[model samples]
Structures are given as C-alpha cells and as structure tokens.
Target: MAELKAGVVATLETIRNHFPSHVITTRATATGGAHVIIEDVPLGPPYNQATTWVGFHLSDACPYDDTYPFYVRADLSRIDGAPLRCPPLHSTGQVFPADNSTTDTRDATMVSRRQRDQASFVFESPLSKLIKVLKWMLEQ
Candidate 1:
C-alpha cells in the first residue's frame, strides 16, 4: 500500500476532498498555523467555519511515497476569545464540561480501525457530499 506525507499538508487535502464545498479562504502562515475559512455554498449552506492555527506536527512512521491523511486529529472549530460558548474538542478523546467525552458520540456510531496503534475518526454524514466521491473512488 502507498501513503502520503506525514503532516498537515496531507490533512489539508483530506479536508478539501471531504468538504469541497467549503473554501479555504485563508491559508496559515509559514509557521504552520492559520485560519481556514469555509464558505457555505448553494448545495451546502451559508455557514463560515474557521479552524485557526491547528497544530500540524507529524508522526514517526509517515510514508511519503504516496499521498494520504498522515496525521490524526479531531473536530475542527473556530477558536473563541473569552466567549460564553463552549470549545470544540480537537480530539475525540477530550472531555467536556457536561461530564461526557467526545469519544462517546464517536464510539456510538463510528467503527474502529487501527494502524500502528493510532486511531482515527470515521463517520459518514448522509448530508456530506464526500460520500459521492467515496462511491466513485470505490468504483475505480
């Protein structure tokens, strides 16, 4: 099997392929952190989501010969500034103030598959257009 770069660049491609309707309005600086603004489209909606400066460290066993999602992370959300809103979990294992972990929801629905002892999140949103792409990928 082939693989991709073990870093943020590959994750960015995953985001683009999964959410093509969303636009990366702003790219991060050379420092590996920046704001990604996603605009809702006609088929999608009118919501602008931003993930500012999400960390992009790589793992030890990344295969650069091919291309794929190299890193594993959780939900991406807009960072707040002293707001009354709750923060989004960067990883599914994180705990929330309501005495529940993000993993609960994930465990309830997502199937688990492991590689090299690292886990990844996977769920097919019926509303996600990525499913169409996935179907096409399987056909080919």
Candidate 2:
C-alpha cells in the first residue's frame, strides 16, 4: 500500500510538471488511492461531454482499472455548492499540493489557463494525437 501511494504521488508530480498551468490537489481516498482534483476546470454538461470524449480516446489508448492506483471522475455536483473536504489532521485523509504548497491556491491565472487549454484540446487537436500523447505518458 505504501508503494502504491508513493507511485501515485510520483505520477501526480509528473502530471503537475507536465501541465504547469493546471492546479493539481491530492486527497487520500478511503480506498488508499488518491482523489486528484484538477481544479478550475469547468464541470457540467459540456465539460462532461468533453471528458467522455477524452475518456473514450484514452480507454482505447490505455487500460483503466477502477481498483488501481487512481481513476478519473467527473463530479458535476462540485459546481453546485458542494464543499470539498480536506481531511482533518489526525485522519488518514489528507490533502497535498502536487506542486510546491505555495502555488496550490486556485487563482484567476490558473483557472483561465486551464479553461483555455481544455478548450484547445477539445476543439483544435486531433483526437488520435491526444490519445497517443496520453498513452505515451501513462506507459512512462
């Protein structure tokens, strides 16, 4: 379990480095794997649609194991006043920044950049290329 958690941390760090403009937060899940929050990305009908499209492409490019180290989920309820829980200090659940702690806050710059990048990927890039890149990253 420790090894898996370490791997998850490493993978999250790599993803954070790759997407410097995006905000990445990690919270310990009851299942041992972490819930990675890609903050500032819009959630709802259209965004869910885009994620579904991406997931379809990703699934063909990589295997998804729901019981593995992690899984991607689209939680639209977050936009509708749901509070994000940060674990209490003594609890096994704890939150950490993917980057250095100082930069973890969700700000205008991060939000705008995330929105722009998401839009660009959904609209401008070819799905095949995106799939290839994501597959390559996962295989790394």
Candidate 3:
C-alpha cells in the first residue's frame, strides 16, 4: 500500500461525504495519490442504464492538479441507439493510460473532459471534476 497525500485524502473524504450511499473504492499509488472508483452512480436520460460506476486517478498533485479523462462502464450506450461518440478504452490486458501502473478490473469507456481554461482550473477539485464529467455525459 502507498501513502496518500493530504490533498488526495481530503478530496476522497469530500467524495465519500457527498455520495454517502455509493460504494467508493481506492487503490493508493506510489506517487501518494489513489485510483478511485464510485459505484452505482445514477444515470439520466439518453443513457441506457440506471446507474454505473465512475473511476479516475487522483494524483499526489491533487487540488493543484485537475483530474482528467474519467472512466465509466464500457458497455454504456445511448438509449436512442446512437454511437457513444467518445472513444472507449477496454480494460482487458491493457493498463490504464494515466499512470500505466494500475489495471482496473472493469472494462471502461474513457470520458475525456479536461479543464480547458488554466485560469479557472485552480477552482476545480477531483469531486467537482467528476460531477462536471457526469453532467456532461448525461447532457450528451
């Protein structure tokens, strides 16, 4: 097990506090961050499933660093039967792209929503980024 940074721990605490009902798991990284996954996250219109898990890497540089390219259940599709548009990264024997150290058990669709404005990125946290990604996915 790797030690977690204070910022990463704080962000994880916030996530757990907000989504009290969800199952959140973490695998600490050598860099003092963690691989996080929140299961059973509710989905909205346009999505085929009622809920799915969301995963992301909260690096040691958290709070100061933006969490990018989240992961969701790979089989996720639109209810309208259209293409997902976003590229899906299947987690078969391939290691996740972020750190290339951890292997996620679930096959996931990579959601590439990064913080565009460097000025406003200071205001973004892991929890906030996750929420924004979920909202963006639901809207798409």
> Candidate 1 residues 20-49, lDDT tens each?
766544333334422233334222111123
User: lDDT: which is higher, 2 or 3?
Assistant: 3
lDDT of each: 0.28, 0.32, 0.80
Better of 1 and 2 by lDDT: 2
- Show model 3 residue runs off by greater than 4 Å: 87-98
* Clashing pairs for predicted structure model 1, backbone only: 3-66
The lDDT leader among the candidates is: 3
RMSD of 3: 2.9
Q: What lDDT is reached at residue 1 by model 2?
A: 22
Winner on TM-score between 2 and 3 is 3
- The C-alpha local distance difference test score for the whole of candidate 2 amounts to 0.32
C-alpha RMSD by candidate, in order: 13.4, 14.7, 2.9
Question: Candidate 3 — what's its lDDT?
Answer: 0.80
Highest TM-score: give the candidate number: 3
Residue-wise lDDT of candidate 2 within 48-136, one digit each (tens)?
22231111111111212211111233231233353332222011121222233234422111110011244344342222333343353
